[model samples]
Target: MTTALAQRPPATAAYSPPSYGLVDRVAGLRHHSPGRLQLILTTLLTLGLLTGLVAGLTAHSASAGTADLGNRAQPLMVEAETVYSALADADTTAAQAFLAGGLEPAALTQRYDDDLARAGTALTNAARLVPDDSDAARAVAALSTGIARYSALVATARANNRQVLPLGASYLAAASQLNRETLQPKAQALFRLATDEISAGYDAARSSWWLILLLVLSVALGVALFWSQIYLSRTTHRTFNVPLVAATGLFAVLILAVGVLFANQRTHLDSAAQKGSAPVTALAQLRILVLTERADEALTLAAHGSADKEEDFERASGAIYFDDPRLAYAERFTTTLKDRHEAYLTIHGQVRKLDKSGDYDGAVALAIGEQATTTFGDLTTTLDQAIDNRKAAFTDEIGDAGDGLDLLSVLGPLLAIAACVLALLGIRARLEEYR
Candidate 1:
């Protein structure tokens, strides 16, 4: 038995008395071996490399989220603007034709048809984009119905005008109410949606800057660790620790590059929003202004043609339904509309005087030339110019926004993956030396 024990090397020191506790076990383990400086360096370098990788991943994620939201919103905003413009233009053409003496010019008729068709198509596209249950989708659907009904009313009004029946005026009044009540409010809702999304995009863009700071920290930490490892190697007279230095340098480059790329991407997105979306929004507002004026003018004319004051009162009260329920009566239409009405009242009083004097033709001619053509038409052209200016601005901005983001969308991921792979390879090279 003694010979056997000696041959078994005293049973390997009886497993070191099973350690007294966890702390004791840890103490005992440490007593057996001291960590090399190179190992400490490697540990720090590995941590920095992981931190850089995590930062890169986070930046990529944030950028992707921003890109997705902005990209989806862009085309939808375009569709909304197109639908609004088409509806407004159609109303304008119909009103112009009415002022031109019962004669619906072929061109005006065709324009109405085309615009109506375009509006329908646009609404269909919007529905597909917005989903069945969204508020935006509901607003669009309501607007579509209102447009169809208004178009029919306008047609009826034009037909009645051929017979010199005052009922045409009544139809015009109803159509004007539809424009105010259903379509405008719906349009406003869509605008709010677009604006909200745009603001969110700005938030996303701003938030991404945090990634840059993380990158900076990671790079700084990596450099510090790398230098520490070099110092240790020189002091200890070890030639090198391949994994430790390699991981530090690799992570440093990756973190720094990711930060730079993200900064560039954010700048590009900002440029896009400023150039394209902002201008378009302004133009869209101008178009709304013009359309409101046109509808108000049509209502005034129809009120004048009504048989009794009762009809006029009913139409005015009914027009209220078209305005947003949330807004007070005074705020529903433009201030210029009040001015237009004051001017109309003056002309109307003069026409009543002419009627008393048996100068009906003179009154009629004055109504068409001054009230219809000059007052409303000239003012509309001025507003149209404003609309045009805004439209041009929006077009340029949207183009820039799309181009800038799309560039980042393509380059950001590719560069990020490449950086990650390079960092991993550098780390692996050091790890391989451990074998």
Candidate 2:
């Protein structure tokens, strides 16, 4: 037996099993291994990446919204308004020139030419801005063709008038109808489309609720990590981990800064929509009304006692020179316009009476000569002043809105990257201490 035990490697150290207390087993179960630390680091880094991605996306979206509102939408809206105004003014000028007969004044002819040039330029600008297959694009193309046709008609009318032919009146009437019925409505539709796009941009800028929620969750994760660091300090009986603390501070500041920037951007956009776009649009509509009335007045004489033209003039004048309860504060400006317009209607009435009584020379003198000085001329001055005032208001409000959003896109992604770097450094430092 002794020889056998010696041969069995000295009996294997008495054969007693290792002892383990309950506390030791429980501790082993609870303790994190190196692999667990790696897992925790991976999870933290993933969260950091997610947060950064979300921040970058939100920043990009906001930046795009800002650009659309201030750069694309507002400018398009203004251009559309320009087109409408130019077309209306052109029709009115054409009518005024016709009333001057074959010997139209140099100033009146020059004004007509200027209006046509402005309309063409505005149409080209609008076409460049709109998408290729869009309704706005189609409208612009159609208007281009229509303008060519109307010009040809106007030229024919001028030639016939120089030869003392009554057919000039019929040509002028057809061109005016084309402007009133087709071109004006198309321009209005384009304006509406541009305004709709502006509204969409405003909505996009304001709608950041999902981004805000994601940021809140990211902040919560940061707080949890901070608390975990504190727990580790207590359990390990070591000083605080500085890097983790720094990461937490950086994350918090990022959230706060982003929140502030988003809030300010939203405020500025709202102000622009309300104070800038709204007032300018109202004034533009008012300008169209004035141009319509002027066209009606001239068309009445061009039609030579056509009751239809007289009725149209009266209807347009009523809309322009009356208080509209639906328009609210806009009524105040219209009140001033109304006073000037009433004076015009009085002279127009006298001119019509002279035409009906066979006093054709007197009617022509009042309609297009020095007698128009106190009536149509004064009305034109009033409309010009109103347009200038509204334009200034639009410029100031839109400019402020645009300036507020300058730094948001750059700062957002930068801060996100900083937070991610800080988090990785912090976790790596804590892991090194464990190793």
lDDT of each: 0.56, 0.70
TM-score of each: 0.62, 0.80
- What residue pairs are clashing in model 2? none
**Candidate 1 lDDT over residue span 87-189, tens digit each:** 7667666755565556677776887788788878877777766745777788788878888898899889888987899788678667756765667567677
Clashing pairs in 1: 180-322, 181-322, 243-430, 272-401, 275-397, 276-397, 276-398, 280-394
Q: What is the model-wide C-alpha lDDT for candidate 1?
A: 0.56
Task: Give residue 144's lDDT in candidate 2 (0 to 100).
Answer: 88
> Which residue runs does candidate 1 get wrong by more than 4 Å?
1-66, 128-132, 155-168, 209-213, 216-224, 227-236, 239-243, 305-435
